[model samples]
Target: MAAAGSVYEPLPRPCAFSPRSRDLLAISGVDGRIQVWDTRVAALRREYVPSAHLSATCTCLAWAPARGIQEAHQKKRRKSEAVDNDDPYDILTIGTATGDILLYSTVKGELQSKLVSHHRKVNCVRWHQDNGCLYSCSQDKHIVEWNTQTYKVKCKWKGDSVGVSSLCLSPDGKMLLSAGRTIKLWDLQTKEVTRQFTGHSTLVTSLMFMPIRAAADSRSPPETTGLYFLSGSIHDRLISVWQVRTEMKQKSAVLTFTLTASPVSIDLAPSDSKEEPMKLAVVCRDGQMHVFEHVLNGSHKKPLAPTCTVQIATSGGDGDSTPKPVSILSAGFCPDKQSMVLYYGSSMQPLFEKLVLKTDEPHMCLIRDVKKTLTLRKEMTVTKVKTPVVKAADTKVLMPGIPGHSATVTAMTVNSETQEGKRKPGDQEDTIEDRLGAMDIALPKPPTKTILPRADHFSVLLLQGLESCDSNILNKVFLINNETEIKRTVAKLPVHCVVPLVNEITKRLQGHPNGAMFMVRWVKAALVHHAPYLSALPDLGAQLGSLYQFLEMRVKAMQKLSRLNGKLYLLITQIGAFQMAQRTSMQSSKQAKLVYEEESSEDEEPNKEHNASDDNWEEEDEEAEEKEEESEKEEESEGSNEDSEEEMDVDKVNSDVDPGNESEEE
Candidate 1:
């Protein structure tokens, strides 16, 4: 028997294989091109430039399952119209740097749409088998849902404060699992966060959901299958399984299993086959692949230990000669259930393959096919088994800000204009009366006088004490204050300081320049109220205060710049509106000047023309009489010209028609 926890020597680095069934094997090269090798005679079949223009590395790749559909329709004439056709071979979805997702069809060997919705580098992409939707997560801290048919965004789920590193969909397509530092479960139907599982101390690298069973137990009243979620954490080098019980009122979920190795990727065996038990495949950072079979007891209600474990060799050599194991970036079983493949490495040529138990493993190896032996007995027992009376516990925890302050709470009131309840100004007479009536009779009126805390309260007491102190002493005080007030403030420090504050204090105590400046700014902000001593300690107080103020101003400026950049981006994208606004401003200015000029000239024109109107009217009447006689003569000449043109047109048409008649007579 193999040692209980012995590490296996993996195959050599940069190894490639073609599965026994597949004719073409895809290998991603360091040059950012996918090389397709014909394994039948073990040679290169074709080299496809999926992303030849991209300089960034390819992070992940997945092939969609080929689905066959058969539809039966009734025609308008009462005849049955049946059509059956196999869906096109699943497209290959590749995720790369620059946050672009490319889909390629294997049948056509042509590139499909390039999904460019993600703002940052895309980390992973997964296709939902049942819905044919693509889910992709990126370093932009966003997970996008895509419609595979239309290639349009269906929806987007934003991550909380961190870039998403991995994503997975449940078997039923009802739940979406995503991971970064925390694991979040989303209900696809509601598009709301269902639950957040916080167990990993570091980043969660990968996640997979166990498959649900198909048929209900005959003896039981059709019990629904339970859901199980698995996650890999980098900090603890552990694999955790979480059981999700939707039936429970509280949504009872808990970690069920934890492994020792850091899992980089995980995949569960397809649950379609009744003869094969469910299995989990996990690839670890140590360049090892582990597979475990799911075992069920007689009741088929509780989970048992894995029946068997297989650790495949991925890289090889003695400890001293062997290079450090690169992470297994991704792993998946083929649709035919013949073999599995895994991609590992940080660079472009990261993918590697391993041929585990083949499709014939069950039929050829009798001892290994445990499910086949128990198939008959299991069916008989399952059919006759009686349903057990099980009570589900209430798992609902009160949501924050429901009715009263149950936990930590804070409140802020907005002005009446901003309040959710709309009320006109000066229309609160009834509201005031109702509030007064609701007040307790025994309660005394609160003090009307406002109290301003003393200036000393706002003064930087720590800075005053540290004045003229050495840098070492100031550093010590800063450390102490950081420890003390860290919990009081809600604002999170930047990433560079977070690890030092939370994980390592001693390592950062080396008095770095950045840390010194941070301490000085903090101390200065603390000492602003010491006006009396400010004159005496001008250098310390003034400089520190100025520095503090400068930092604050810089941060505000950055925020403003970000807002301005967003506006500029919007302007560029919305060209029509921007152009219209510019045109409207120009037109308004010109119109304003024209209006002013018209107003000034109006008086001059009216006065000058007013006196000449009587003389002009006499001349106009005489001209009108003479013009009418000339106009009648001109009208008669124009009418004769129009009549002549019409006659010519009619004669031309007759001549043209007569030629056709003559030809027929001849």
Candidate 2:
């Protein structure tokens, strides 16, 4: 069994490649120092050390996505001379053993911000590509999701009682895989465990997802819903590859293969062909890497064997005949997937090497053309270094606040009315006794005018909200107060609060646009109602001048926007007119076609009428010819009958003649 103290021992230096540029690698060193190197040229780019005392070493490192780089650049107000010229806005996140996460910038070569939410060491950190959300797991059994824009904890949940030692996010960014004694997959949206694997006997140290594009089928769309992941445990000397399917709804994770090695880190290189599985590289503690070619070929019934095992040898010895074997700390593939960068050796003098994959030979796949990129040296120290503190001018340090208003409290007591000097009652002699008795009589009290308090409820609430310097509370206060109430509140505000109010408005004007409109109105009312009081204080005038400048800039922007809107409107109008012209032309063409069709029909109708008239005349002429032929035949018959007496003889003769002629023709 391993010693219990081994669990709390300092982890190796964490290193990671930039998500955007594989040539840029970030490695953490002792004393909370981070170093960036250009792997392509084997050159050191920048090195950053935290100003505060760091007792713990970095446990993990991750580079923020390119989108985060853009965000950092956009948020920057001014350029720093120390910023790197080539890559001016790169951010690297470092997780330390103290359970604190530090955001370091390559541009400024300094720490950007420190986040603390864990009591134990942070084990792993992962970034989601789409939303730029950061997920971190720690030995405190806590998983925290952070919003990169605000650097605030967006969500926190207890992942497992044993504590998570590693984390990997799915390609779709909907599922998360965390490894400890048992590997568990979580649904990020519901924060529920979707699947669990208890194959490993020891804590899993490294977890990585297989590249989705490498396994995608060309016949279908890329399968981002499912992926294979590799998890390694140092104590067990085992690397297990598991496959998740169907949006992480698989009843169980299919273990594709298990490779044996005390893996310090695991990385996968996407393959070019679907027939070939991704190349799995596992860097072991003894400076040995096991490269498996067909480990994730989708056959989970049996474990696949590694294709090649490469040994990493040490560079030189301290004037000795033989050098000690190198101890690899971490290893990761390059962007091209053809080579890898390795960080190894002791922390006192760490070394970096670029290992290229050589597939030309069958037996020896990894070629060690190790290039010495950069070396990190550490010096032992205990004293804490304090940065010099410089106090700013009084004007800069002064913050406006409401001063207490003072008023005198006077009470007048009247016991009796003045008596006439005529001594009405001449009772001067009766005197002292009468006066004392008259003074002793009680007199009715005069009516007192009520004085309202200097501040109203809304004014008090607004003042407290502003003084708290909380935007949400101040926004709520503004939301609840009406325009009349706001005006009254500003008017009642003291001379001291007036400047601060203006300053707050000016600062807010630089923020969200929705609040700026109301803030402008509030500032306007403050200046108008308290002009005399503000003018008396020169500092107040400076604040007002800033407000004016901001408003002027906003006005110019609004005017530009208005001009753009007008141009857009003109374009839309021209398009509408063009469309209208097209419709008119089409309608005219259709009407002309209809008219031409009607004229053609009219011409055909006249031709038809002329042909009908010609047919009628031909019919009349044929009828007349038939009648004339019939009359002629009847007259001939009558003439023959009149000569019947002679015709009998003639008919006989004709018949005889016809017979004779027929015989002769025959």
Candidate 3:
């Protein structure tokens, strides 16, 4: 099975097959030989030794479709009576390591033109469809345009200060984008620079421009096509999809995407007609090629997610003889063959793999909107799928029909139940293996994020904390005890993640008594205390505002039903307090009356006995009464003086504090 998908060479470049016919395949070897294979029998057709003839190593290659062959033949007949048209001819252009571009015909099996202009190695060569001009970039910091027909240098553009690592010509050929210190968009005719995109931290290694939607064949090319292009870097390990604005002045590079692993190369499987879908395949440094569904709404640049990833994992043998997996050097998708070809190096030979793409709608990648995604997930969904119930194992695998297929989750994971039975008691694998084993046998399982607790947990907390009715368990688990903690967590959440959480949070808060007041206070604190903090986080405060707004709207709707509901509740509370106060006052008055009655009764008996029995004693009693009155007055005066001191302290306190701090009730 591996032998069918794998072809062997010594250099890492996908074999260029004839664009017109799928019969011939071209492979360049490290031994400096280019071999043509007949795809019909999978056998060698012919060999050409370009290094022996030109004395230079081949760096890059491209196939140019022969144009007007019959017309050229008729013109040749006028120059000479004999015309040779039967032999198969290939207008192949190969960039060599020795500062030269070699143009040749495979049928004649000889070097046609040794096009030389660059002072350093030629990095890439491509023939633009619109201008019929072959463009080559080199370490010499120059892009030389050559005549595709005459094989002569037409013009040289020194656009970049540094050597151009990668370049892509727009389909219309009016604009050119080259990557060096930065990604630059250039005007072809006026030769003026426009926008410079510096998002990537490192030099961009690869770039390609593709249409967002496949245009109808009946419509003209440029007007009906899409404007988005993709770029990838080695150090950044990111793929950025940039779109050209409507004006085509090259001022704005609206970013459409940023994802993917360390990409070694990328290829687009564009649809030939509107009925088909567009697919983008990225070959990463890891021995995997990820496929994403590229979709858009009209001309708008939308979200991009990978639908699935496919990898070749058939490494065996040992020691120095064993070939470790190498980075994918190049990959190309040929719709005619319905296959994706990936090239990489191995021990003795370069590995050429032809993977069959499942063109059926079910397996094809799909695009989604920007704001749609689960809040609890850390990774974005690159591809969405419908996993059929597997009665045998209840596991999903890659498409069952793709050519040279094998299991991706590995045999160990596929039969983990049995493997677990063999393990020692209480033994556990390390974190990495434990995680890998836990993964489902699916292409991608969007991982749950650790930033916020589980959505279910959060929702439950919201319901319990916001309720006017209190439940202990719900209060502890769901309540945001510290506003600062809530702010910090919310600040880190992505906009897509924040919106859904806020919706559920606001929804719960809306059902509570005084929920609107609670939300208003919360929003006010966030905006006032943490305004600077929230400003650092994109769209965080806005999301919080959304929560407050939802609560406000719900509160307003309730208010419309009864304007005095809050006032009525307040009145009920006040009445309860007043009744309690009256009950306490009545009890105190009764106690004082009983005490007075006891004192008066005791004194009444003593007063009567003194008045009747002793005339001399009456004068003495009057003197004693005067003495008691004097003592009582002095005691009363001392108490009043203490009360006046307490009043003075209270007045000093009131004078010292801010007037607004002392809230007065009317």
Largest lDDT belongs to which candidate? 2
Name the runs in model 1 displaced over 4 angstroms: 1-27, 37-45, 50-53, 67-90, 214-223, 249-260, 270-277, 296-666
In candidate 2, what are the lDDT values of residues 502-555, reduced to their tens digit?
767777787898877777678778889988766443223223544665666778
User: Which pairs in model 3 have colliding backbones?
Assistant: 9-350, 305-382, 306-382, 306-383, 307-382, 307-383, 461-478
Compute each candidate's TM-score over C-alphas.
Answer: 0.43, 0.50, 0.45
lDDT on C-alpha atoms for all candidate structures: 0.52, 0.65, 0.57
* Residue 292 in model 1: lDDT: 57
For 1-666, candidate 3 gives per-residue lDDT tens digits of: 021222111123434555544455566664446666554443454566432334455666777655512222333233221232343445677776557787766544556677879867676777777556788888679988887566678888896887687778887778888887688888877767777777765557678887645455555555455577778875465577776765654433454433445575677866655555667777665545667764533433454555666644324333444333334455567656367765544311334556677634333322221122222222533221212122334333322222221122211324656667676779776697667778645566567964755655544453443332344543353355566655554554433233344444454465676544444433444355445544433223223543644555667788676767778888999999999999999988878554333345777887798777785886787899999999999999999999999999999888678576555531
Two-way lDDT contest, 1 vs 3, winner: 3
Query: Candidate 1, residue 380: CA error in Å?
Result: 53
The reply for model 3, stretches above 4 Å from the true place, is 1-25, 50-52, 68-89, 212-221, 246-261, 272-276, 298-305, 315-330, 336-355, 359-666
Error of 3 at 593 (Å): 68
lDDT of 2 at 302: 57
Sort the candidates on TM-score, descending order: 2, 3, 1
Question: In TM-score terms, which candidate is top?
Answer: 2
Per residue, candidate 1 scores C-alpha lDDT tens digits across 351-409 of: 34445554223221111222242343345321111111222221221212211111111
lDDT, candidate 2, equals 0.65
